[model samples]
Structure formats: C-alpha cells, structure tokens
Target chain A: MRLFKRQNNVLPGFGLTLGFTIFYLSVIVLIPLSALVFRTSGLTWGEFVTTVTAPRVLASYKVTFGSAMIAALINSVFGVLVAWVLVRYRFPGRRIVDALVDLPFALPTAVAGITLATIYSPNGWVGRFLEPHGIKVAFTPVGIVLAMTFIGLPFVVRTVQPVIEEIEIELEEAASCLGANRWQTLQLVIFPMLLPSILTGFALSFARAVGEYGSIIFIAGNMPMVSEITPLLIITKLEQFDYRGATAIACVMLLTSFSMLLVINLLQKWSRRYAD
Target chain B: MSAPVTSIPTSNGSKKRTQTEPAAVRWLLISIALVFLTLFLALPLFAVFTQAFEKGLTVHLEALKEPDTLSSIKLTLITAAVTVPLNLFFGVTAAWAIAKFSFPGKNLLITLIDLPFSVSPVISGLIYVLIFGLQGWLGPWLQAHDIRIVFAVPGIILATIFVTFPFVARELIPLMEAQGKEEEEAALVLGASGLQTFFRVTLPNVKWGIIYGVILCNARAMGEFGAVSVVSGHIRGMTNTVPLHVEILYNEYNYTAAFAVASLLAFLALITLAVKTVAEWKVRQQLDNN
Candidate 1:
C-alpha cells in the first residue's frame, strides 16, 4: 500500500484538514460515544440484563418501538402520497405546500410537543370532535405515534420525492399502451423501482422516531408502563441518579442506533444497485 | 393484427391521453394530501399562534417580556452562536478532506461523521454527563478544578454541537464531490496556494451548500430540545434554553406563556424554512444555468 501511494498530487493541506477532522471527530463524537460503552461495561451481564429488562424498562421498549413502528408506517403511506402529489400534480399553493413539508424538521420539538398535545387534548381543535366519538389522542401511545409521525414525515417525502421525479413517464405510457391499466402500471412498472428508496425512507423514519424524545414525552402522557418511551425512561433514571441503569438502557438503545447505521449502509448499496 | 389504440381516446374522457392518472383520481389524491398536510403540518403551527394569542396579545407580549423567558432566549442565542461557528469550521475542514481525498477508510470516515444523527439525543447528552457528572470519568477532576461541563452552558453547547455535527459536512461533501477537484487543481497549477485556491475557487462552488447547511445547523442548534434538555438540568433563568423554558411553562399550566415563547421559536422555524426555500431555489437556478 505504501509502495503504491501516490505523492504526486498538487493539492495541499490534506494532512491538516484530515488531522483536524479526525481529532475533532474523536473528541466530539467518538470519545463521548465510547463513554457509553465503557460505562455499560461496568455492569455485570446479570446487572445489565436486569437493568434493561426490568418490567418498566421493558414496557418502555415496547412503547417506544411499537409506536415508532406505527408512526413510520403512517409516514411511509402519507409521505409517499404527499411526495407523489407534490411531484406529479400541480395544485394551488403548491410551493407553500412543498415548503411546509419540512415544518416538523425546522420547528423545535418542544413546540411541536406542546402544540400537538394541546391540539389533541380532547377539548382542543381536532380532539373535540374525536372525543365525542370515544377517541382520545393526547396523553396516550397514540399521541406518541402522532408526534413520531410528525417528526418522521419529511424523511419519507424528501427521499421518495426525487425518486418519483426520476421515474420516466414513458415507461408508464408504454404500460398503458400495452393495455395495462393505471393501477397495473403503478404496481407492476413503478413500485419495484421505488421499493428500495421506500424501504430506505421507512428505515430512516423508523430510526429517527425510535430516538425521538422531546416531542414524544410531552404528548406521551409518560405513564410508567403505558406511554413512557425509552428515552423518557432514560431521563427518569438520570433524574433519580440511577446513572448505571440509565447507561445500561442507553447501551441497548445505542445498539439500535448502530444497527440503523448498518441498515442505512445496506440501503444505500441497494439503492445504488437499482440506480445502476 | 392489433387494433388501433389511438382511436381509444374518443371513448375515454376528453381530458387528453396522459400518463398521469385520471382527473378524478388526481383530485382525490390531491385532496387527501392537502387534508393530511393540514391536519399534521399546518394546524399545529396555527395552533401554536392561536393558543399564544388566545389569552389576548397583551398576555402573549407579557410572556415574551418575562425575565426567565428573555434569559432563556439569551442562552439559546449564545448556544447557537458558539455552536454554529465551531461546527462550521469542522464542516469545512472535514468536507475538504473527505471530498478531495481518496485515502483508505474514507467511506468509514464519512459514516462516522454522521454517527450523531442516528444516536438518540438523550444519549448524545448522556455521554457527556457520563464523562463530567459527579459520578463520571472526570467527575472528581472537574469538581476539583471547579470546571463544569455537563448540566451547564458548556454542556448545552456540547450537546448542540454533537446533534448538529454532520449538517454542514454532509451538505458540502456531496456537493464538492460532484464539483470534482478540477477547479482547485487548475488554481494550483496556475500558482495559487492551497488556502488561496480554497478561498477563491472551492468555497465559491460550495457557498450555497454551505449556506443551506449553516442555516439548518443553526436552526437545530437553537431549537434542539432533547439533547439540551438532558444536559441542561433545566435550571430556570440560568441554563434553560428557549425550548426548555417553553416546556417548564407548559408543565406549570402556563399554557399562554408556553405558547408565547413557543411562538417566537415557531417564528424562527418559519424564517429557517423561508431561508431554506430561497436557498434551494437559488441552487436550482444555478443548476439550471449550468
């Protein structure tokens, strides 16, 4: 490798820039993240299992993962619809609608939390009508789902939108001329091409929702076993000065993040393969 | 032997043969999208403002003028001020290295840069606490030195930086990668120094991408809640940022006050979105020209 290394390049400062990048990355991200692993290592296997698998913590896992799944699924459907409409059709106020897709990303999570809680709290705007029909949103797992869906909305729409735009209309026209109906064209011709990106978007939305905290906590009602999410559970542990327990649970959650990183890598490869 | 399909349009509706779905289908899809967006995106934004003004504009104004609220705003500003520039420097350097170089483990480095995005914000904040809190790795040393990192202004800044670590770099990497090293190579061959070439050629090429990244990074830095909250200790009038302040107010049953402070952030979000839209348009225009 050293023998093959080229030193003939004209560009300079590679050493300075790369050194700074590695040093900064190590100090800011790598070292701190390793602290989680180091701290978790202090626990015995028994202790780790007990901390992560406690009934309350287990419930939070269920709540967090379940609601995030539901939320990601919801975003996958509606986000694709939004992207499809935004790309394929022109309606009034389209630019405004397009810009608004990113509101959840730009809006502070706390503001989203309070606003969502207020709007869905039985006596609030949409909640008032739903309450009459025996539906309660705020202070429930459903509210957690709502918040997650809101935060994850832009991921799917943004990801799928470009892919949708890249889809050639001639393919659809060919399908139609071949006597396949609209639905057949979409299902047979288009959906396969879009699948990889759709999965990527779904995975991204799910990952973001899984890690979400500020927005879900306010709306989640934070009942010990019912609506409490894992992030909130970690906060609860930290508040109680249960540092060991907090990191233990955080270690498990961190595993999820690492796995997400892997999944993202694989998805990128899959999408690249399709692109080629 | 095939029938002439061109004549089929006469039997179909007069809406011209297009690859798109029929008009009725289009209207249905558009309506669904509009309603869904309104319910999820538009109304909550509307709610933040309406709730803020529900107790009259005077109360909303008073909430904004509240001492704690003002202090939180100050802290938020300070945090963003410090965090954005630091991350901006890292972003440019990292992008410069990764985009222009082809060393081994380059892909791994790129992925590592994005590590914070996948991690939970609580964990992002917690990692520092684990290092600097009373029970952490440097806890005794920090306490002895009277240096505070976690649960203070420094902690807040650290967490914001972590959460926003990848934004600028991520924006520039792809952009610079696509722009290729030709321009900088040209500048160098013309006797320009490395720094000179960077400032004159590379920076201009990625200026819009940098702007887009900085705007986003700044917005997240100021608006970050979960990470900042985990590290902030939520000490009102001191460590609490704007989002945390809103949380405290809302939890204390100060709905009007909470939404009032929240309206300001909502405004920030709107401004960020507006800038983002304009930046995106500018970039698109540049692309079209190219």
Candidate 2:
C-alpha cells in the first residue's frame, strides 16, 4: 500500500479525517456510557448487589433472559426457513413476501406491541379462537415470547438471506451425486456452509430480544416475577425514584449483554474459520 | 457423453425424480408462510381497525378529536422533526469520516455507534433520567439554571435521539465504504474543493441511503414508548406521546380510544413503509446504473 500517495485527489489529509471521527464518536457515545458507569459506581458493593439481585429483579431477569433465549431459538429455525424460501424459489408474490420479512424492522416497536396485545387479548379475534382451547396469550409469559419472536424474527431472516443467496447450488448437487441422501446432503454440504451465518443471525436476534422493551411491555401483563422484564424493572425503579437502584441494575444488564455478545462474536469467528 | 445405460438402477432413478421435488414443494412452502404471516401480522392490524369501528365512526371521531390525543400527535411529530435532522447531520459526518479514513480505535468507534442498537431502550431511557432527574448528579446544577429535563419534553427528545441515532449512520457506512475514494479523488484532482466535491459528487451518491435511514429514524421516533414512558411521567395533554396516550386510555378501560389512536400511528407507519419502498427502489436503480 502506498502509505502517503494521494489518491486521484479525493479528500486530502487522512489524519485530519481520522481525528474528527474519533472526537465525534467519543463525545457522542463513549462519554455518555462511561458517565452511566461512573454514576452506578456511587453505590456501595452491598448496595449494588442488593439493587440488582432483589427478588423482583431476579424474577425479571429470569423472564427477560429466559424468554429472549427461547424466542431466539424459535426464530433461528423458522427464520432460516423463511430466508431459504425467499432466496431459492421464484414464486408469485415473492417480492411481497420478501418485503414483509422486513416489516418488523420498519414497524414501530410500540405499535407492534399494542397490536399484538389487542389481537391476543381474550376477546380479540385470534385470541377468541385460542381461548376456547384454554390457551391464554396476552398478559402472560407466553405473550412476552410472542412479542420478542415478532420483532426478533427479521434479524435472523435478513442476516441469513444474503448468505443463502450467495451459496452455490452445485455443492448440494455434488453431495447427492456422491450417493448421499437428502438429509445427508443437507447435513454434509448445506448446513456446514450456512452454520456461521445462521449463528450470526441467531446472535443478532438474541441480542435484540434481550434488549427489547416497548413491544413486550404492552403484551407482557407485567405482573411481578412472572411477566415483568428487566427493562421494565429498570423503568419501575426509575419511576419509584430509585436512581442508584436503576443505575445498578442497568450496569449489570449492560455488562451481561456485552459479555454475551463478545462470546457470540468469538463463536462466529471460529465457525467461519472452520467452514473455510 | 457416456453411452446410455442398458438399465437404470431403481434407486438412482428415484434420486433423479426427487430432484424436481423442490419445485413442487415450493408452492406448499409459500402458502404456509402466507398463512402464518396473515395470522400473525395482518390479523392483528385488522383487529385494531375493527375495534376502532366497533363503537361506530362517531365515537372513533370523538376519540380522535380529544385534546390529549391531538397534543400527543403534535408532540411526537415535533420530536421526530427535531431528532431526525440532527441525527442525519451527525450520521453523515461520522459515516464520512469512518469510511474515508483508518486510525486507532476505528473499530471501537464503530461498535460504540452500534451500542444503542444492542442496548435495550428501557436502559437507554433510565440512563438519561439517572443523569437529569431531581436526584441525579446534575440535578442541582440544572435546578439552579431554572432548567428541567426529567419529566419534560427535553427528556423525551433526548431518549428518542439516543435510540434512533444509529439508524442513519449504520445505513450509510457500508454504502459509502463500498463506493470508495476513486470518484472523490478524481473530483479533488480536478480542483474541486473538499466541501464542493462532497456536495457535488458524494452527496448525490449517498442521498438514498440517508433518506432510508431518516425514514426508519422517523418511524421509530414517532412510535417510541418504553424510553419516553419512563421519562415522560405520563403527564396527559402535556408530556404524553401517542403510545403513552394509548396506554393511558387502555388503563382507563377505554379500549375504543386506545385502538383509535393506535390505528392512527399504524397508518403513519404504513406511510413510512411507502416512503421506505421508494427510497430502496431509488437506491436499487442507482446500483444498477453504476
């Protein structure tokens, strides 16, 4: 690489541009997050632990993290199928189906929650059918899963769709020609190739689900220890004027999410290298 | 080509026949997806419309005319107007710098920009309150200056900005990076000043991406609930946004009013979808031409 050669003449001075970028991001993002950590540090160690580990907070952690994991798992399977259908086939209304896969991305989370709650409430159209069968959705843990699944599905689908499109059909055909059965062909050829991208999709969906608040709150019924999510807990603490408590809980969540994401990124890198 | 086989093995023949199975199964798959989406997405939206009409148009209209509902809409639009433009400027400048240069902490800055996307909105709202609330670190200073941030419009706007800031920047980074420095270099070589070349060449190239990001930011800002709710204090007709307004009505057992306002926001989202489609189509056209 020509270290200092001026390209045709574009923007001069790479040093100047890089400085601006660092200063801009530092001021806007890093400072604010660091301030959050600094504020939470005001609490004593015992207070910090108690604030984040209270019975109600523990219940919220279970609901938020547990439902998010389950929802991400469900999305990983179905989102793969949705992406496969969009990429591998040419059908009537294909464009519309492709577009709708992005609906969750475009729809406002609040409106999505409100709509889901309305449709799943006892007398709501779909809920009416389920109620006869004794299945309650809205205001339950089940509804939290549904809301998370609704918003998280697109993350998995969109992430995997491009990788699916890029994969060559010849690999599957080659596997079949080698006397492999359909299941074998999928397992030996396609699945290995897709594993890394699928996991990327899963990680993205999981992260989104864990952080989700608006869409779940409307449908979650928000009963203590049952339907309340971590985000809701943080909000509840804030409303109650528990500033130290809110910051402490938020710090725990931030650290946990960051570590999980770090682990997922490592897994993704290993899988990609393995496939290559 | 090899000579035709004297007799084809049954198993091999069946394998060949199954090659076309995917074509046949494709329709079955499409139908299943269509039904699933209708049940989950379309039906729920339909439920909102039906609930709005259940009390007759007169009541629905009355709900719309309510002062609180109107104020919520106004406040939401004003916040979107303020936040989106500011983010657009910041997004473009940051994206430009990131794409055009490399330095220490480049990757870290990218991750920082995406932090809001990964962090929960609930936490985002709480962070702002923890800073500006009456008991917050800056509370005394803000009070001394006769400025109130928490439970006010400024708090709502700040929360909205935090969550939506990443949208436009995320959209433009990859697009701008891929376009690279060739055209920009050519313009610069021709004596086009830095700002002039950017406006004349670069801006046209990235405008569609910017528009798409703005559309997304606007949609999220208008319908933001968790963050705003945490900070707004739910002051009806004062600090309430539409989503908060709907929640209040729903809490009061006013289902008609709740769904009516929700329907309005849903309609606005539909318009957003339309704008997004146009923006995407424009970008696609540009890509094809290039």
Candidate 3:
C-alpha cells in the first residue's frame, strides 16, 4: 500500500525501539502465553474435554463465573454511585474518599483476602452485627462475591467517573424542559450516555474477578466443589503435578476470556456509535 | 426555575449543584458514598493495622524482625527494584515506537502488551513454569545446566514484569500520541542527536505520565501475589515474598504476625496511593495549564 511511504522521520531509533518492543513482548508475554495453548494442544480431544469438564473443574467454573458476574453487577451499581458522588457532589473528605477508591489496586490480594476474611467472619466487626440476623458472608459464595466486588470497584468507578464529568448540565436541562422529571431525566438522558462505559467497566470487573486467586482462596473456604474458584483449581492441579490438566484448564480460561473481551470490545465500538 | 423551587434552601447547599441535583438528593448521595466507602474501603485497611497492633507494638515489631519476614521484605525490594526499571525501559521504548510511527499491527502490539492484565495472574506465573519448571520445556536443559528460573528470584521477576508490562507503555502511548512528533521533528531539524532529542523533548513532555506509570508498576510489582505464588514454590526465607509470608503466618494461626507483615504492604499501598494522588494532581495541573 505504501509505494512511497512518507519520510517525515523525527530523531532516529524507530527501528531500535520497535525491534526492542517486539523482542521484549515476544519473550515475556506472547511466547509464555502461547506455550500454554501449545501444551494444551498435546492433549487428545477426549482428554481436553474431560480435563476441562471434570465435575470439580466444572464446579469451579460455575463458582468463578457466577460470583464474578454477581460481583460485577453489584459494582456496576455502587461504582456508578461513587462516580456520581465524586463528579457531582463535593463533600468534606472527598479527596480522601476519592483516593481510597484505589486502595484495592495497591493492596496485595493476599492481604485483602485475609483482612476481609477476618472482618466478615462471624466474629468480625461487621459480621457481629449481621450474624444475629443470619446473614453470613465469609467463606461462602457471598464472600467470594464481596471480595470480587471490592477489587472490581476501582475499575467501574475510574472508567465511569470521567464519562460522568464529561456529561453536560445543558443536556439535563434540555431533558427537564421536555417534561421529564429528575428521575426520568437521569434515566432517559444521563444513563444512556453512560451505558457504554458502565458496560465496559462491568466487563472489566467481571474479567478480573474470573481470574482472581490470591484474594478469593482465603475467604473462599476452598471447599472443592462448593466455593473453589478456577484459578485455585488450576493451582491445585499444578501442586498435584498435573501439568497437562493445569495447562488444559488454563487454556480454556485464556480462550474464553479473550473471546469474551473481544466481543465486549466490538460491542463497545458499536455502542459508541450512539454517542455521536 | 432558579427562584427557589419548592422551598429548597439555598443557604446550606453550594450553588454548584443547584442546576443538576437537589440539595436533599445531594446529601443522600454523599451519605451513601461515605458509608459504602467506610464499609468496603476504610475498614479493611483499618483491620490490617488494628490487627497488626492487637497484641501490642512490641509483638508486631518482633514479627517484622523475624528472619523469614525480613528476608521476604528484602526479596520483595529486590524484585521491585529489578522489575520496575526493566519494565520502564520496555514501556518507554514501546511508547516511542507506537506513538511516533503509524505501522500495521500497532493495535495488536498494544493489546499484546496488555495480555497479562486480562490473563489470570495464576496463568501468568503458570506460563513461565510451563517454559522453565522441572517438567517444563526447558526444565531438563535448565536442570542439566543448574539454572533455576522458575521457583526462584528470576521467576518472581519475570512474573512481576509480565503483570506490569502495560503500565508505563499504556500511560505514555496516549500521552505521546497527544503530544505528537512535532516537537521531536523540530529537535531533529535543529541537528540534535536522537537520544538528545528524546531526553530534551519527548521525555520532558511525558515525565509526569512516566512517573505515574512507574509508580503504579512498582506498586503492582511489589503487591503481585497470585502470579508470583504460582511460580515461587513458597520456600521460606528464600522465595516466600512478603505476601506469601503473610499467608504462612496466617496459616500457622499467628494472626498478629500475619497482620504485622501485611501492615508493611498496607503501608506501601498507602504511600503508593499518596504519591499517585500527587502525580495525578500534577497531571491535572499540567492539563489545565495547557
């Protein structure tokens, strides 16, 4: 296509930088990730199916995907609330609260798990309040959901906050002038504009939660079929020296997550068409 | 509409939200935000510190002084020191190429750089093990040569690097893209050397973005657990990082000790957050100036 490529070259080293970028990306990320699929390819069809669809592995998929979905949904709601607050309202300690939104990103997953597990246990600070009401959170699917929600919050909030800030007050005024009440204006006017980003945030949070391991394992009770997650299961297979099985499971997750994200990306592109 | 809609007081509330939100609704939103943050964000952090000091400061201090704990701290420091700079190099190089040139597969390159972010952390570590572990592709070769990659410091560094691959590049790509090549083109026209142009022009433009990215990458490299755990074999005082050490202490029913080691990481998180906020503020200030 480039019969005569433009030579508006700046300071040189384009070759050097591009070469290094490809080399480092190849060695560290591409090759290693490809190795998983390559190793999985060694499996027979029956072997692959059985390994990925084994009862326990299947259960883990259910737990991981189900909890992640619930967590993403919860985050979608609250994360928007938080973003709304940050963008629209200015209360005292707003900066501190804003900074706190990112704590999960910096905090070690292991630390988050242990701390959350302790705090939500039956004898925990908040747990003590809820225990008498028969509301259990730690060491169940709910605990998994809670952990996922915590870690996923930053994603939704960060993504949506900027979009909210971009929303014009004139648009809301226009909606109200069209005989829409405040609730109707927010629902029909503001929410549609924010939907694409909220969906992106939800997809991101869901993806993270699906692959989460260190945090979930502690509060998860690690009950094999009941509450165990896929990542931990992959670890268990490795610990048991089941390399083939481990790679097989890892391959499934890799493909599904990649395809899912690809679809979401396309959907986002489609959604942005409405924004214009 | 501006003239006192239905007895809503204008005194207590800022005039900022009068057009967008009712005063009562604003208060409600703020209250929910506060309580939700207190429950989800504040308490867990508080728990980490309060539990660390539950058995008094002496015991907590002793936990940090434990040989394995101290070693874990040392290993974590070394891991971050090595990984952050290496990744930063890749980030700057990658950003330079992608931002300055319009090439085919450019988007694909960006996605590949971010591959580890979407992939499971366990899988991130597992991929390295598949290449270099005892039963890995190079396992026999590594064993014969007595070269340990997985289950050692090198593996930890690799996983940390993989997980943090996108941070600096992602930060700078958009920044450099926005800044464009006009400045660099001018520097070149002025007869500056390539590296000279980069240092004097490109680097200065993206300095804040790079700092923000580097800080985030370092925080992640230090706090990464699942990937490092998968590759690390959890050898005490050897491969067990601070996170794994916290796990070990917790498994041993040493709550105070676990939380003590964890507090160090929590402290790291706080410091990272603070610096990040400052960097963000600087970025915002620069944006406003422009």
- Predicted candidate 3 versus true structure: per-residue lDDT over B2-73, tens digit per residue: 221133223265455325677777889889888888999999999999999999999989988999999999
Q: In model 1, how many backbone clashes occur?
A: 0
Candidates, DockQ: 0.59, 0.44, 0.58
Model 3 regions more than 4 Å off: A1-6, B1-18
TM-scores for all predictions: 0.96, 0.91, 0.95
lDDT of 2 by residue, B1-290 (tens): 32222231232243444222354466787677677667766676677788877899999999999999999999998999999987887788888888886657877777778877777778778777777887777889999999989899999998898889899989888888878878888897787888888899999998899899999999889888877887898898999999889889887989899889988887877788778888988887876567
Report RMSD (Å) for each prediction in the order shown.
4.1, 5.1, 3.7
Question: What's model 3's overall lDDT?
Answer: 0.89
Q: Which residue ranges in model 2 land beyond 4 Å of their true spot?
A: A1-10, A13-24, A267-276, B1-20
On TM-score, the stronger of 2 and 3 is 3
Could you tell me which 10 consecutive residues in candidate 1 chain B have the lowest summed lDDT? B2-11
Model 2 error, position B113 (Å): 0.7
- List lDDT for all candidates, in order: 0.91, 0.81, 0.89
Q: Pick the candidate with the highest DockQ.
A: 1
